[model samples]
Target chain A: MRAVIMHGPGDVRVEDVDKPTLVEATDAIIRVTSTCVCGSDLWPYRGAQKSRGPARMGHEYVGVVEQVGDAVREVAVGDLVVGSFVASDNTCEICQAGFQSRCKHQVMMGSVGTQAEFARIPLADGTLVKVPGEPTPAQMRSLLAASDVLGTGWFAAVAAEAGPGKTVAVVGDGAVGLLAILAAQRLGADRIIAMSRHADRQALARRFGATDIVEERGAEGVARVKELTDGYGAHSTVEAVGTQESMMQAIRSTRPGGHVGFVGVSHGVELDGRDLFNATVSLLGGPAPVRRFLPELIDLIMADEIDPGAVFDLELPLEEAAEGYRAMDERRATKVLLSV
Target chain B: MRAVIMHGPGDVRVEDVDKPTLVEATDAIIRVTSTCVCGSDLWPYRGAQKSRGPARMGHEYVGVVEQVGDAVREVAVGDLVVGSFVASDNTCEICQAGFQSRCKHQVMMGSVGTQAEFARIPLADGTLVKVPGEPTPAQMRSLLAASDVLGTGWFAAVAAEAGPGKTVAVVGDGAVGLLAILAAQRLGADRIIAMSRHADRQALARRFGATDIVEERGAEGVARVKELTDGYGAHSTVEAVGTQESMMQAIRSTRPGGHVGFVGVSHGVELDGRDLFNATVSLLGGPAPVRRFLPELIDLIMADEIDPGAVFDLELPLEEAAEGYRAMDERRATKVLLSV
Candidate 1:
């Protein structure tokens, strides 16, 4: 099997590796049909984040179950399935409360590396959602998105309380941020503002239902959002970028009683308590509970109600995984889909 | 008129000052009957916060209306009333959304010095809630509590989502924290954990409906909370101490998907974004919008349903204002009421 592995900064490779096997009674072997490079992967590839060792990469995938352990009752061989980046039991109190990413017995699927010919999913009965039927090519791409980005975006919108009469501001121009626009629009937000400097991503943001665009960053970005919102700031804000500047912008861009949903993985951000207290905004974020929204996202994708797969601006074979990483790290591709 | 003035750190005095007169069309003058020394007062008194000149000393009070400007129609002269620490129009969008403390035209009453014989209240229509009828000394004290501490605790409990079947943990044993336990109990939380080291405060906490007591501080305190909840942490937490350790303890004590509502005046706390992100808890805190809860609190106090005024264990006359500050500063009193 060929799998993506990062040897060091700026060095990602696709090399021959042993196929995954079911290691637990609740495990299932997935023959990945599609996977993609994430903006988060660029963190370590750019050396902004430290790498522990030669690490297995991808955590998002849509695949066919090739084998199933005896205890895996929800998914079986030959079934098409989508699973969240984090494997969860889905029955724990936390998971039941819609925070499956923090489930009591959770496992990061990135450790198994879904960018491969075969990957093992633990807690298969709870983590993997079986697709209703064979998906069309485009639908397969959307289903792959449901495994992470789309669900994450949905979670961000929900956390931000982006719905009727709300003015929502999105801080990042990555795939997740673009998809958050879609989610906010779907959630009935009155207006969506995408803060992006790029022409291409901005266009995609518009297509995904952004009613306005602000080509600014930091304090200036927050100022523009406030200016557009009658100096009261947006009612809701989605922070898809995890830098200190982005976090502050999100918090400051919301009205006193508004919500700021930050989905970006934090790197080196430290928030002053005084600033947060004075902002008087509600904040909810972290690794999104993608598993909580997988079912609905899958239905939306299969029904052609949403086209989140459009985020994949570049595509390649699994053997060209290095190029995929390079493209995203260099900002040449918003997202790169890998045909496994 | 006489007012409480802080000449410098550890220097409080009761001195003759000009009585306040209506300045704004919406202003009303009140003859203060009761005011109290707050835990936050200790910050400036202890020099933890920098002195901003010789400041007027108090914000919380229950009083009788003395005079009103042409636009003040909510309460007439001689009417007993309780107003929030912050004056707001209450008609603004933020105030309408139940965040009156952060209203666009908000005025901090601390600057107006409610600890005086007569004080001016801006936005009288929005800031002051008239009591139902005349009150006994005990009810008058409780109404004064509702003007700030009691309302603040109620807001914290509401923000932490304390309700039926939820396990609540309160950090800090000050008037606000102890009152939060009462608020949580009233909101029907299944269990309440009070974190405190003082025996007197713990007894008050138990009286206020704390089902459990964790005397430990910091990590040890969080450990005890987790131990009590079968290692899952509490579902709701109130942070009423604005220090770094207290803020982090409140966040750590809550389970993922749980809520942390903080209302202490922040001093020098900084939160690591990574820690908060990993905690996966919802955070909502600030100077409480006390005006929002004034009406209900007034009704409860008048009906004798609660006794939040018990937090004021010490009392002093207007001439002994300095002693009131000293008692609270030296930990001899949890709260001290001043008869103005």
Candidate 2:
């Protein structure tokens, strides 16, 4: 089986690796149909996150179950399924509270690596959202997105409390942020503000129902958001970029008593205590519990109610996985999809 | 009129000062009946926060309205009132949203000298909650508590979402934290943990319905809290101390998807971005919008449903206001009340 592996910074290769098999009573072996690169993936690919030895890469995938262990329930062989980046037993107290990312039995699928021909999903009963059937090619991208980005964007919107009468501002121009605009719009936010300097991402943001676009960064971005919001800042902000500057922008962009749902993988960011304390904004974020929203997102995708898949601007064959990483790393692609 | 003023670090004096007169259309002059020294005031007294020239002190007070400006409404002359440290128009969107402390027309009463014999209250109608009538000496303490400490603790509980079936942890054993235990209990929390080292404070915390007390500080404090909570931490944590250690303890003490309501006047507390992000706790706090909870808190105090003022162990004549500051500053008192 061909799988993606990282040797070092800026180096990605697709090499023949042993296929995953059922190893637990609750596990199910699945043949990967589609997987995509995430903004988080760029961390190690860019050496921002150190890679020790060659590591398995990717966590987002939509696949067909090839085999199921004796204890597997709700899913079986031949079922088309979408699972969250973090596998969780949805029945746990924490999972029941809608924070599956922090579930007691959560396992980062990235460790086992989903960017491969076959992978075993643990806690199959609670981890996988079985689709009605094999999705058509037109819906493949959206289903694959439901595995992570779309669900993550949905979670961000929910955490930010973006809804009727809310003025939501998104800080990052990545795939997740773009989808966050779509999610906020879907959530009935009265005003959607997208802060993006790129022409392409800005256009996508607009198409996703952004009411305004601020082509600025850092303090200037916060100023523009405040200016647009009658000097009070937005009612909700989705921080999809985790740098210090982007985090501050998100915090400063929200009005006092507002909400900031930050899902970006935080790196080297330290929020000044005085700033956060004085801001009086509710800050909620982490690895998004995307599994909680997969059912709803899958329904939306299946019904053609939302096209979150449009974020995939580039596509490649599974064997050419290197190109997918390169496209995203170089910022040449908003998101890259690979068919296995 | 005599007022407490800060001459310098470790220096407080009660001296003759000009009595305040109504200067704004929305102002009302209140004859201070009761005022107290806050933990925040000690920051300047202890030299943690610098003092420039001699500055007016005190922000918490319960008093009789002595005079009213032309535009004063809701509160009039002779009305028994309790007001928060910050005065607000209460009509602003921010105030309507229950964050009166951040209202557009907010005026920190500290600047107007609430410690004085006669203090001018701006936006009197919005800032002062009318007590049912003149309170008895016993009720006086509770009413004065409602002015700041009680309201702050209540806000912290509300912000932390301390409610039915929730486990709550308090990170400071000052009046506010002890009162927070009471608030959490009233809010229906099943378990309330008070983190304190002082036997007196811990006893008061238990009296206020703390189900458990951890006489530990820093990392040990968090470990004890985690241990009590079955290694998952509490569902809600109130941070009533502003130091970085307390802030982090409050955050770490809360389970993922839990809430941390911090009401301590943040001083030199820097939240490490990575730690907060990875912890996935919802953080909400500020100079509590105490005005928002005053009406309900006043009702609770009036009905004898709770007694938060018991935290005030020392009382002083307004002429000996310097002793009030000294008692609190030297840690000889959990809280000090001055009868003006």
Candidate 3:
């Protein structure tokens, strides 16, 4: 089976590897139909994050169950499914509280790497949500997105409390941030501001329901948001980039008592306690509980109500995984869908 | 008129000063009936915070309206009232959103020196809440507490989302933390854990409805909380100490989907974004919009349903203001009420 692996920083490759087998009764082996390169993947690929030697490379996937362990009751052979980046027993207190990513018994699916021909999904019943019907190629891409980005963006919007009467400012222009604008729109936000300097991404942001765009970054970006919000700052802001500047921008761009939902994986970000205290904003973020929104997202995609798959600007065969990584790392593609 | 003045760090004096006069049409002159020394005052007194020369020393007070500017309509001369530590216009969008402390037109009452014979309150119609009737000495003290500590505690509990079926953990043993236990109780939290090592404070915590007490600090305290909550941590945690350790402890002690409401005046605290992200808990904190909770708190205190005044373990006349500061600075009193 061909699988993506990283030999070192900026060195992603697709090579033949042994197909995965179920190691637990609760596991299911899935033949991946679609997968993608995430903005987060750029962390290690760009050497911003340390690599633990050669490692398995992807976490997002829409696939068909090829084999099921005896304990896998929710999903079976031939069933289409989408799973969260993090595997969780949905019954745990944390998961039940809608924070499945932090479930007591959790496994990060990134370690299992879905950019492959076949992958073993642990806690199959709890981690994978079965798709209701056959999906077209476009719907398959959207379902693949439901595995991570779309659900993450939805969580960001919900966390930011972006709803009717809200002016939501998104601080990143990546796929997740663009999708968060869509989520905020669906959640009934009155206005959506996409903070993007990139023209192409800004266009997509507008297409996805952004009512405004501010190309500025940092303090200037916050100032722009405030100017647009009657100098009170936006009612809600989403920080989809984990850098210190983006985090602070999100916090500062929100009005007092407003919400800041940050979904980007943090890297070297240290927030001054005084700043956070003085900002007086409600903050909820981290690895999103994608599983919590997966069912609804799947329904939305299948029903054609949302087209999150539009984020995939490039597509490549599994053997061309390196080019996919390069395209994303160089900002040539917002997201790359890999035909596994 | 006499006022408590911080000449410098560790030097507080009761000095003759000119009585305050209304400078704004929105101002109201209040004859200080009662004021209290706050734990935050100890910060400047102990030199943890820099002193900007001689400074006014208090922000919490219950008083009678001595005079009112033309625009002061909500409060009138001779009416007893309580004003939040931060004076707010309350009509601004921020205040209307229930974040009065961060209102567009806010005045920190600490600058007005509430521990004086008479003080001027800005935004009187929005900042001062008149008492329904004459208050007994007991009720007067509680009303004074509502000016800051009680209201701050209530805000913390509310921000932490304490309510029925929730387990609340309080991270500081100061008046605000102890009062937060009372607020959590009033909010109907099922279990309340007071993290305090001081026996006297612990007794007060129990009286205020603490169901359990954890003496451990830092990681051990978090561990104890998790042990008590079946390894999931508290559903709501109040951080009333603005130290790095207390903030982290509060964050760490809450379950993934739980909330941490902090109200302590932050000094030297820096939060690692990674730690907060991985914790996956909601965070809301700041100076506290005390005015938002004042009206209900007054009703509760006036009805004798709560005894927040019990936190004032010592009392002093205006002449002994120096001793009040000393007692609080020396940790000899939990709180000291001053009669003007």
Candidate 4:
């Protein structure tokens, strides 16, 4: 088996590794069909997050189940499937409440590394949702997205309460933010505002149903959003960038009593309580419970209703995994897919 | 007319001032029958908040309408009314959405100085809710409570989504928080937890429908709440003391997907975005839209179904306003009422 591992910062290498095997009664061994370098992967690659010895590199994947443990019921041998970044026992009280990320029995796929030839997924019955059949190449790409980004974006939109009559704003132009625009559109938001300076990302945002784009940042950006919203600000905002300024912009761009659903992984940012208190906006965000939305996202992708995989601007062979990481880390690509 | 003015920190004086008259087309002059010192007043008294020279102090009151502007339709002269701390034109889009405090034509009663013998209330028709008729002394006390603390606390409970089968936790033992327990009970909350260390406050909390009392602060308080809630924390948390620690405690005491409604006036506190992002709790709070709940709260008070005024532990004459402030500042009274 081959897997990508980072021994230290700026050091990603794909090398031979021991193959995965079913380790728990709820575990399933899957042969990777495709995987991708996520934006979050840049946290350690850019030396922002501390890395220990030989840390596994990926958590997004589309695969075929090769073996299943005794307790695995939803997936079987040779079944095509999409699994979330976090493995969760759907039977837990938290998962039952639609918060799979906080499931009583949960496992981060990062530890097992989905960017490999073979990986064992814990809580397989809860984590893996099977595709109708072997997917076409484009379908496969969209299915791979369902493993994390699509589900995450959908969760962000849902958390933001973006629906009919809502004017929604996305703070990040990354894959998740772009997909959030699509999700908001699908959820019937009347207006979608995308904050992006990149020409290419802006085009994609427009394609994903963004009704407007604000090229500005901070207070100016918030003002622009207010201008578009009759000076009331957006009714809902999706914060896909977890920086201090971005969070504040998202909060400020939302009208009083509006909702701000933030799904960005906060990178050591602190929010002033006074600002939040005075804004009178509802703040709801965290590690998105992707597993909770995985099934629906897979159904949408399989039904050809949404094309979220357009976020994959670059593609490569699994053996060239380092280049994929470099491309995403350097902002040369929104996402890079690796064909295994 | 006499009014309580804060000359400086730790300095309050009751002095004769010019009686107010209708100044705006939407304003109404009211002869204040009663005014009360709030927990927030202590902020300036203790020098936590800066005060300008001879600034008027109170924002909560019950009064009789002395005069009404040409445009004042809902309220007229000689009407006995209880108005919110912030006067809001309830016809605005924001007000229609139940966020009257953020209405375009909102005016703070604090600036108008309800502590005076006569106060001018702006947006009178939208802010003042008249009682069915003149009432008894006990009913007057409850009606006064409806002016601010009761309405604000009820809004907190509503924002936190307290209802049947839910467990609610209230942070802060002030009038608003104590009233929140009663509001939650009325809203059908199965259990109410009041975080209070004072024996008198705790006893009052229990009397007001608090099912449990946790005499702890910060992390320990959250832990105790979790222990009582089967490790999932409360379904809803109302934060009535605005501070970094209290806000965090309220957030921590709520389970993932739970609601936290905060109404405490923030005093230079910063909330860590990372912690909030990871917590997966919904945060909603601000200067409460008391006007939005005025009609219902007035009904509750009029029916003699609830007595939120029990939180007022000290009563003084209008001339002894300084003692009212002193009692609240020294923590000798949860709340102080000044009869004119």
Candidate 5:
């Protein structure tokens, strides 16, 4: 089997590796159909996070189950499925409370490297949500998104309590942020504001039900949001960028007693306790429990109700995985999908 | 009229002052029946927060309405009332959303000198909650507690989402923290854990419905809570101290997806964004819109369902306001009441 491995900063290579096999009784071997580079992957690619001896890369994938261990019950051979970045045992107390990311028996799909031809998915019965049938090419793209981004965006919106009569503001223009706009719209938010400066992304945001756009960043951006909201700020703000500036903007853009749902992976940012206390806003976020939203996202995709896959501006063959990483790292594409 | 005035840090004196009169169409003049020193007052008293020359002190009071301006409709002269630290026009959008502390027309009662024999309350129609009628000394004490500490504790419990089948952990043993235990019990929390080391406070906490007491701080305190909660941490944690350690303990003592309701006045504490993001806990706190809970709290007190005033361990004549402040500052008393 071939997998994309990173040796050092700005260095990605496709190398042959031993095929994965069922190591646990609950594991399932998946033949990767499609995989993509994630924003978090850029952490190591850009040298923000150190590489740990040629780290196994990707964590998002749409695949077909080729084999299952004795304990796997919900999925079987040849089943098409979408699995989260982390495999979790749904029976755990945390998982039962709708926090699968914090499940007691959890395995990071990143270690298995979903970018490869074959990957072992632990806790298969709880990790994989089987699709209705073989999907169309477009549906395949949406199904791939369900593995992480779309589910994450949906979770952020839900955490922010974005629903009917809410004015929601999204702080990033990445795939997850764009998808959050769609999720907020689906949740019946009266007004959806996407904060983006790029013309192309802003147009997509508008097409995806964004009622407004604030090009400014930080305090200025917060002021603009306040202006638009009659000096009250948005009812709910989604922090899709983990930087200090973005987090502060998300907090400031929300009105007193409003909610700030943050799903961005924080990289050494510090929040001032005094500011948070004085702001009177609720903070809810973290590594999104993607597994919790996979089923609903898959249904919406199959019904053609949402086109989250539009975020994949570039696609490449699995053999050209390096190019996919380069495209996303350079901001040339919102997301880069690899056809395996 | 006489009021406690702070000439500088560590310098408080009782001095004669002009009696307060209606300053606006919505203002009301109240003859204070009782007043108290708050934990937050110690900030300026200890030089943590700067004083602006001969500043009038005290923000918590229960009093009789002596006079009402032309537009003051909800409150009438001779009505015994309890109001929050901040007077808010509860008709505003923010107030209507249950955040009266951030209301558009909010005036800090501290600035109005609630410690004075007579104080002017702004937005009287929205700020004052009338008691059913004049009552005994115990009821008066309980009503005074509702003016700030009890209301804040109730808000913390409400924000923490304490309820039936939930285990609640309180992170402070001060007056507000002790009252938080009572509030959680009133909300039907199955178990209340009060983190306290002081023997007096621990006993008071238990008397106020605390089922357990953990005499540890910071990480160790969180560990103790987790050990008591079957290794999953408490379902709800109330942070009554605003320091970094207390806030972090409150966050760490809660299970993933649990709530941390903080109401302590933040003093120079900074929260690491990375820790907060990774913790996956819901953080909600602020000055506490006490006005929003005034009516219900008053009802509960009038019905004699809960007596939060037991937190006040010392009482003094209004002329000895300095001594009351000294007792609280020296930790000799959890709370001190000054009778007018």
Candidate 6:
């Protein structure tokens, strides 16, 4: 088996590694069908987040159950499935509250490295949501998205309360932000303002139902968004970039009593508590309990209700994993899908 | 007319001032019956928050409607009323959403100096909620509490989503946090934990509804709260102290997916974005939209359902405003009420 490993900053490599096997009674072996690089993965590759020696990479995975341990009941061998970044028992109080990312006995999928020919998923019954049948190529692509990005975007929209009559604004034109626009539209948002300066990403944003665009950055961007919403700012704002500037933009773009769902992996961002207190907005976000939305996302993809796979502008064979990482790092690709 | 004025930090004086008169058709003049010192007032008094020369002081008051302009309809000249620290026009979209404090056309009650013998309340119809008939001395004290502390506490409980089967933890022992216990109990919380080191405040918290008391502060306090909640922390936590340590404690004491309602005026607190993002807790707060809860609270108090005024441990004549401030500043009193 081959897997992606990071030896240090900007040193992602594809190397032959031992194939994974079931080690826990609740674990299942998954033959990786599809996986992708996440924005958070860039943190270590860009040297923003420290990498402790050689690190296993990739958490999002869409695969087939190659084998299952004795305790696995819901997900079975040969079943097509999607799983989140966090594997959990799903019956804990935290999981029941839709925060499986914080489940008491959670296992991080990143630790197992899913960007390989095979991976072991712990708590299979709870972490993996099985697709009913073999999916079309299009459905497979969307299902791969449901493993992380789509579910994360969906959580942001829901947490922001982007429903009928809401004017939603998105900060960061990354894959997740673009998908958040689609999710907000699907949730019946009255309008969506996408903050982007790129022509290509702007086109994709418009295609995903963005009603307006604000190209300015920082204070100017916040002012433009407020101008688009009658000077009251947006009813909801989704922040997909973890930088301090992006976080402030998201918080400032929302009106009083509005909601902000920030999914950005906060790197150096520090929020002014006084600003939040005076702003009168509700803030909710996290790593996103992707497992909570997988079932619905799978059904939506299977039914051809949404095309979240459009985020994947570039795709590569699993052996050329280095190129995929390079393309995303250089901003040449919105998202890069790896077929194993 | 007489009013409390701060010539400088620690320099409070009751001086003769011109009586207020209706300056707008939406205004009403009130003869103040009772007013009180607030925790936030100390911010400037102690020179923590900068103060301009001879600033008017106090925002919490219960008064009689002494005069009304032609346009004022909801409240009459003979009616006794309890108003929020912030005056608002109820028709605005923000107000309709239950955030009257952030109303498009809002007025700070402090700017009008409620501590004065007479106050001109702008947007009278929306700001003042009339009490039914006359109020006794006991009712007057309770209503005065409702004017600020009690209303703020109720908003905190509501914002924290405290209710049946939930465990609530309050992270301050001021008048507001003490009353939050009462509010959470009324909302049907299964258990309420009061975090206070002072024995007096702890006793009051227990009387109000606290099922447990943890005297520890900072990290130890968070650990104690988690131990009490089966290592999952409280389902709802109210933060009523706006320091960095208290804010961090409140965030750490809540379980994932739990709600935190913070009502303290944030002074110098700055939140680490990465910590909150990974915590998976929902945060909502601001200055309390006290008017939203006034009607319900008035009924509750009139019916003798709760006694929030017990938080006021000291009473003084309006002429002794300096002593009142000194008592609160020295921690010699839990709360000081001024009879105007």
| Model 5 Cα lDDT, one tens digit per residue, A247-311 | 99999999999999999898777888889998999999988899999998898999999999998
TM-score for candidate 3, residues paired by index: 0.99
lDDT of 2 by residue, A121-211 (tens): 9989889989985567868899998898888888899999999999999999899999999999999999999999999999999999899
lDDT of 5 at A234: 94
Q: What lDDT does model 4 reach?
A: 0.90
State each model's CA lDDT, in order.
0.93, 0.91, 0.94, 0.90, 0.92, 0.93
So what's the TM-score on candidate 5?
0.99
Comparing candidate 2 with candidate 3, which one achieves the higher lDDT? Answer: 3
C-alpha RMSD (angstroms) for model 5: 1.1
TM per candidate comes to 0.99, 0.98, 0.99, 0.98, 0.99, 0.98
Q: What is the lDDT of residue A213 in candidate 3?
A: 95
Provide the global lDDT of candidate 3 against the true structure: 0.94
**On lDDT, who's better, 5 or 6?**
6
lDDT of 5 by residue, B1-340 (tens): 8999988888889999988877799999999999999999988888888888899999999999999999989889999999999999999889999999999888988898888798899999999999996577998999999999999999999999999999999999999999999999999999999999999999999988999999999889999999999888998999998887898899999998889999998877788877887788899999999999999999988888889989999999888988888898899999999999
lDDT of model 2 at residue A246?
89
Off by over 4 Å in 1: none
Clash count for each candidate, listed in order shown:
0, 0, 0, 0, 0, 0
- Candidate 3 per-residue C-alpha lDDT over A1-340 given as tens digits, one digit per residue, 9 for 90 to 100: 8999999988988888998888999999999998999999999999999997899989998889999999888998999999999999899999999999999999999899989998999999999999997899889999998899999999999999999999999999999999999999999999999999999999999999999999999889999999999999999999999999999999999999999999999999999999999999999999999999999999999999999999999999999999999999999999999997
**Residue B196 displacement in candidate 1 (angstroms):** 0.9
- The 10 consecutive residues of candidate 1 chain B with the worst lDDT sum are B132-141
Best by lDDT: 3
TM-score of chain B of each: 0.99, 0.98, 0.99, 0.98, 0.99, 0.99
For candidate 1, write residues B1-340 as lDDT tens digits: 9999998999999998998888989999999999988888899999999987788889999889989999988899999999999999999999999999999999999888888888999999999999987798899889988988999999999999999999999999999999999999999999999999999999999998999999999999999999999899999999999999999899999999999999988878999899989999999999999999999988888899999988999999988999999998888999999998
